[model samples]
Target: MNQPSPKRRGRFITLEGGEGAGKSTQVEGLKRFLEDQGIALVTTREPGGTPVAEAIRGLLLSRDHPAMHPDTELLLMFAARAEHLRTLILPALEAGRWVLCDRFTDATYAYQGGGRGVDPARIAALEVWVQGPVRPDLTLLLDMDVKTGLARARGRSEADRFEQEAVEFFERVREAYLERARSEPARYRIIDASRSVEAVAGDLQQAVSSLMGTGQGT
Candidate 1:
């Protein structure tokens, strides 16, 4: 009788931060570092990834709509997340590829729950529903002062819906992320992002190494 090899579940890692906090940049750098070490990986993002979710992402990010209600935005984000998880995230985790996600349910908590003044309980419930058992094993939060991050974000052309938010809005969102990180220390690593990109990347590598039990091999 031939027995199958045990399934190798992948570690789910997510990068979270306010707009312009350099999440995309760092994710790319970290991915390169991890690959250099010979670790197989899959990189993806929420409110996207799946075809349906990417369509939802368009609605969520569309700057053409000025009157989009907060509740509507929240629901849309969750809807996109649900599709992304079922079609993309879950499969990647089950296939033994380390999944590096750009953002996830935490963004809903920070952006809509904290930034748009939505009810936290609802946000929590939606997260539980959408993400279920496949939550990130580690979430790297790129922490930077709102003013600085926003300035960096603003320098980039075409502010997204979140970037269009007021500084006070993002301040609350930042607080929300910090609050979550504080409450869930085992799952969240806060990286000070005000430093130079190389320094932040160095710090990020260290954090990821600690979480994953070795430098991705490099």
Candidate 2:
């Protein structure tokens, strides 16, 4: 009898949010939680996770440069995503190391599609071309009031190009995220990000607990 090799591909988990949703903070906490559970994983962020993609991330975020056209911006986003997928995300998942990401294509849908007025259908087309069937097994969206989120962002650091957009822009971004979550409840776990750090982390652990055995954590 021919023997088949064991394959336990790692789960892909993504954390998504609007400005000041504390995704960065929760990412670290989730990393620690997973470690405590003896689950091996790597954490990375979108528009980055590789040298080439990071360069593109710089261009996307920098206000020092002239603004990119909407179409150009969308293309650049996928360009970075292509590099990130090939170089980091796909490899980690293939090697059976779980992947915890700060953001992913969903951000593009929220930011570029919703905020910038790019068509979601167009984004979907690029998604298919660039990613094939790859998608997060689970997405944790830290949701909160738009104004509060912006205030938190402002307090943390200088506004980047995306951050500098008006509150209306972020409102669209939030709504888009909500719509996606609504459309795909099975893949998404929405968190109340307005709560304290400990509270949010607790909810995050609960959100991912099912993936440990019963499924859905990934």
Candidate 3:
């Protein structure tokens, strides 16, 4: 009698936040902890997870290219996202490896729809097209005030195009993230990023562990 192989159970985890919300730090910290615990993991960021996406990232970062339209920016983001998912993320998940992504579709909705004033309907349509059934199993929304976040961002480097937006833009982006978090409470966890780095990391770890049904001790 022929027997079927065991199914691979893959998990998708995402970190979402406005610029300078310490999402990168938290994601790296979580990845390290997960790796130390011998969890199969692959960490990658959006807009550059694959070669095609990397090319789109170059355009997004090149700020001096006079007046990139919001619609253009939105499409470009999703274009990169589609390629990233098809080439890197989907394959990793199918292989039963946990994927830790820096940002995902929520970022596009917040940044383009909320921050850049694109129509939500337009963003929603794009999301449906690019994402389909592939969505993050858990999204860690790093919450913080826009002023503090921008201050931290400014200290890091000269602000990029998105980072250089007005404070109000980022505020709206934060609201959008929170709204999404509230709407999908089952899949979203809000972490207070305003706290100390260690505190924030602890919250992040707890949220992830809870989602995975693992007791929190790390």
Best by lDDT: 2
lDDT of 1 by residue, 33-116 (tens): 888877778899877988899999988888888689988999999888877776777677677678898988888889888888
- Judged by lDDT against the true structure, how good is candidate 1? 0.82
Candidates 1 and 2 compared: the better one by TM-score is 2
| Alpha-carbon local distance difference test for all models | 0.82, 0.89, 0.83
TM-score for all predictions?
0.91, 0.94, 0.91
Q: In model 3, how many backbone clashes occur?
A: 0
Ranking by lDDT: 2, 3, 1
Question: What tens digits encode model 3's per-residue C-alpha lDDT throughout 1-218?
Answer: 22212232567899999889998777778998887777789999986788899899889977785489888998899889988887788777778788899989989888887788888899888777776656788899999999999999899888787776788889999998998899999899998899999999988888877656442211
Q: Which regions in candidate 2 have their CA more than 4 angstroms from the true location?
A: 1-8, 214-218
TM-score of 1: 0.91
- lDDT head-to-head 1 vs 2, winner: 2
